[model samples]
Target chain A: MSRHTIALAQINPALGDLERNLAVHEKTAEEAIARGARLVVFPELSLTGYFLKDIVSSVALPLTSPFLGRLRDLSRRIDLIVGLVEETPERLFYNAAIYLSLGEIIHVHRKVYLPTYGIFDEQRYLAEGGRIRTFRSGIGRSAILICEDMWHPSAACVASLDGMDVLISPSSSPGRGGLEEGKTFANARAWETINRAYAQLFTCYVLYANRVGYEDGACFWGGSEVIAPSGDTVAKAEYVSEAILVADIDHAEVRRARMANPLLRDERIDVTLQELERIKREGAR
Target chain B: MIDLSLNCDLLRRVLIGFIVNEVRKAGFSRVVVGLSGGVDSSLSAFLGAEALGAENVWALLMPYRTSSPESQEHAELVVKQLGIQSDVIEITPMVDAYFERFPEADQVRRGNKMARERMTILFDHSAKLKALVLGTSNKTELLLGYGTLYGDMASAINPLGDLYKTQVRQLARHMGVPEAIVQKAPSADLWAGQTDEGELGFTYEQVDQILYLMVDRRYELSDLLEAGFDERFVRAAFAKVQASQYKRRLPLIAKVSSRTIDRDFRYPRDWGK
Candidate 1:
C-alpha cells in the first residue's frame, strides 16, 4: 500500500500580478514541502488569476518559459500541480495544469471543457483541449482535471477506466445564491456532493483545490478538500479564506473499496464506445 | 419590518477585494468617486481606499450653492478619514449659468441640471486623473429611478448597486464611517432641504423591504399585499418600479440592422477584453 501526503494551496491570487503570485506559489510550495507533502495542488489559473479576458494572452506562459523553470526549481524535493494559461507556438491559449516532479514538468493537462456560461468566459479566450487521460505521477498513477472539466462525468470515467488511483480537480468555482437560503455557499455544497459521488463511484482518492477570494463581484469559495474512496471527507479548508489544507491519502483504501464493490470491473467499455459512436451520429438530429 | 441581515465584515472584505480587482482589471489603478457625504458615497470611498490604497482613490465634492453645509462637511470627514486626495468642485457657477437663461425652470429641471453638471465635473476629472468614476447609487434608489439619468447614475463601475440603502447604512457603520454621516436622513441634496425620503413620500427602510420582497425574492404584487403590506405603499412602489424599468436598461435600439449593438450584437459589458 502506498501513502502520500497532499497539500491543497487554497490562496488568493491578485489578478495579472505574475511576480507576486509566483512569490506566493514559492512560499506555499516551501510550506508544503516542510509538511512532507509528496504533492501540492493549486487552483485553476493559479499563476495568472482567473477572469482574464484579453489579458489571458498577455499572461500566457509556454512550458519552456522562465516561470516554469522557477516552478521547476521549487519542485526539486516535492511534486507540484499548478494551473497556468499555456500558450502554444501557434499562439493559441489553453487553460492547463502542469505536473512537475524531479525538477521537471512531468505532464500537462489542458482543460477539455471550456465553460462559457454565467460568470465564466474561458471559451472566448482559450482553445479547447482535445483529450483527458491518466498519467503515471510521483504520487502514482493520477489524473489532472481543471475547473469545468470535472463537471462532465465522462471525463472522470476516462480517467478512472485508464486506471488512475488519484483524481486531482483544481478549480476556481464561485459562490452563488446563498444570500437567502440554506448553505452560505451553494456552489461549494454542489461541489462537495459531486466530488464525493466521484470518489464513491470511481473508487479513487479525490483531491479538490479551489481558490479563495473575490474577483470582480464573483467570490471564489475555497473549501478545498480531500475525499476518501468511501465518499467521506478526510480534510477540508475554510470557505472564502486562504488555507493550506493537508490530508494523508492511502492507496490501500482504493484497493479496499474496489475489492468490496467491483463497479469498474462491470463497466462495459466496448458497449460504451459503440453507443457513444451511435449517439454522435444520432445526437445532431 | 423586513429581516435584512447582512454580514458586513465578510461583505466588506469581499467588496474591497472586488473593487480592487475590478479597478485593476480595467487597466486603471486610480478611481474617482463623487462623495456627497452620504452613506453610499462614504461606503464606496472606504471600499475604494481599502482596495487600491488611499493614494489611488480620489474623492470629489461637487456641491451646488443650494446644497446643505452638512453635506460638504460630512463628505470632508470621509476624505479625511480615508486619507484620500480630494477636491471640492462647486457646481453652482456652472449650473447657474444655464439656469439664468431660463429663470422659469422648476425644481426638477434645476435638480436634473445639477446632477448632470456634477457628473460632468467627475468625468472631466476622470480624464485628467486617468481614473474611472465610482458610482454611489444604492439598489433602492436604482430600482425606483430616484437618481438623475446620466448624472449620479453614470459611472464606470458601481459597488453599491446590489446593496439596498438600509444595507448601505449597515456596511457604513460596520466600516466605522463617521456616525454623523451614517445616522443622517437619506438625501440627494439636489435642492435646499430636499431629502430623498421626503421627496419620494416613503422611507428607504419601508421601500427597501418592499423591493426586497418584490424584486429580490420575486414576489408578485398580490403576494406582497397578501403578506400584509399596506396596499397604497405596495401599489405606489411597484408602479414606480414598473414605470422606471426603462432606466435600468440600455437605450433601446431600433433594430434597423440584422445585428444590432446591445440587442443582436450582444456581448458582456467587459467585452473590451
Candidate 2:
C-alpha cells in the first residue's frame, strides 16, 4: 500500500505558554490535515520550551494530561505527534515525545541519549532512556527517537532492531558555528547512513522533525526532512523557521531498496555487537 | 599583562602573524576562512592569506540557497584576486531541512545558524587540511555585541578584531580589495538582500563616526547627541555596546577571594612566544 500524506508543522511556539504552544500546534496540525495529510508532527519539547530548565519539573505532564487529551481528541481526524517534557515518580524529567492517533495516545518515547555538553545540560535535568521502542502509526510500525538519540550509533541500531517502517526524530538542537554546512553534512550522514542503512534494510520510511527559535540564548536551526528508503532527501524545508511540511511515501520503494541493498542479511552483527560492547565499556569508563 | 604593545596599524597583522607562526609551529600548515562575501570575512580572508600564504589559505564559499548571487560572485572574485584555493558549495539543502521542520524561526536565529554553518565548513576543511580557522570580525562588531556567539563569532585566530570599522575600510583599501567589494555596502548577505546597516538601524558612516568619537576620542553620549546624531540611535549604539560588552571580554571569573583571569591572570595571545 502507498503511504499517504504526512504533514510537517513548523510552528512558532512561545516558551512556557502552554495554552499558546498547544494552540500553535493545533493550528498547524489543522492546516496539515485540512490538506488531507494522515500524519502531522511538531518539534521536540514543543510543549515546554527547550530551555525550560528547572521549570521543567513544574510543567512536566503525563500522557493523560488535559493538554494531551485535546491533542488526542484531534487524533480522531488525523495522527498527531506533539513533543512534551514528562516527569517520573522518582522525580527524573524526560525530554519525551508522544504519538496520538484515532483518539488514542498510541506511543510515548523518552529521549534515549542525553546531551550534557555545550549549551545543553539534559543530563542534569533529564533521566537517561535505556531502551528503544517503535510506536505503531498509520504508516505502520515506526520508531521515535529524540534529538541526541539520533547522534549515536547504539541508539539508531537499537531502534532498528525492532523492525520499524519510519524513524520519527523530534529534536531541540542549538546552533553551532558552520552549522548550516555542518548539519548538511551531519543530516546527510544521519539520514543516508541510518535511513539508508536501517530503512533500506527493514523497508521503512524515515521522518525527522526539529525545533526552531531561540531559547536561553541558544538558536535552534530548523532543518527537518523526510528521506526515502533509498537515502535521498525527498523533501526539505527552506531554513530555520516554523512550518508544516508534507510528503507522500511509497511503501514499495522501501521494499525495493531493501531488496537491492540486502544489507540486513549481510550485516556483521557479531562484529558490530562487539564494537558496541567496547563502546559501552568505554562510555562506562 | 594585557599587551598594549600592538598599535592599530601592525596590531592585526602582528597578532595574526604571531598566531599563524604558533599554529605552524604547533604543526598546522594551512588555514580555512569562510568567505561570507562580507566586509569582515573579506578582511579576514585577506589577512589570513597574508599570514599563512595564499597556498595555505583555503577560502570556503558556503552560500545558502537564498544567498544573493552577487554575494557569491564577490566571494569568487575575492579568492581569485587573492589567488587562494576556493570551493563554492550551497547550504540550501542542509539549512532548509532544519527550517522545513520549524518555520517560525526569526532572522536572528537564522543569522546565528548561518554563521555557525559557515564556521562548521571552515573547521571541517581545516581539519581535513590540518589548518586553523581565521576569524573575520572587527572591534566594532565585537565591542557592540553585533555577532552570534559561537556562530560567526567563533574562530581559532582573529586579525582584524582590534581595527575599527573605519580602520578596516582604510586597511581594505590599503590592502587593495577590489574597488567593487570594498565599496559595496557591508551586509552579512544572510537573507536575499540584507545589509548590516539596515538591520542595525544605523549606517556604518553614522556608526563609524559615533564609534570613533565614542571609542577612539572617548566622547560622551551628550556630546554625540549635541553633535547631531539622532538621540535614539546614539542611545541604541551606547546600549548595544554596553549590553554586548560581555561578548567582547573573556569569560567572567568567580573571584574566589583572589585576582581573576581578566584582572590578574591576564596575558597576551602569544604569551610564551
Best by lDDT: 1
lDDT of 2 by residue, B1-273 (tens): 111122234334344544455566446777788887767778778877777779988888998877888888888888988899988877777777777887899987787787777777778887888878877888888877888887788888676675667667767776777778888888877886688878888766667667767875568988887788788888888999999977876687788856566465433233222
Docking class of 1: incorrect
lDDT for residue A138 in candidate 1, whole number 0-100: 75
Candidate 2 matches the true fold with a TM-score of 0.53
Clashes of each: 0, 35
Best by DockQ: 1
Model 1 agreement with the true structure over A61-128: per-residue lDDT tens digits: 98899877888988888898988999999998999999998898988999999999876778878999
Error of 2 at A63 (Å): 2.2
lDDT of 2 at A224: 73
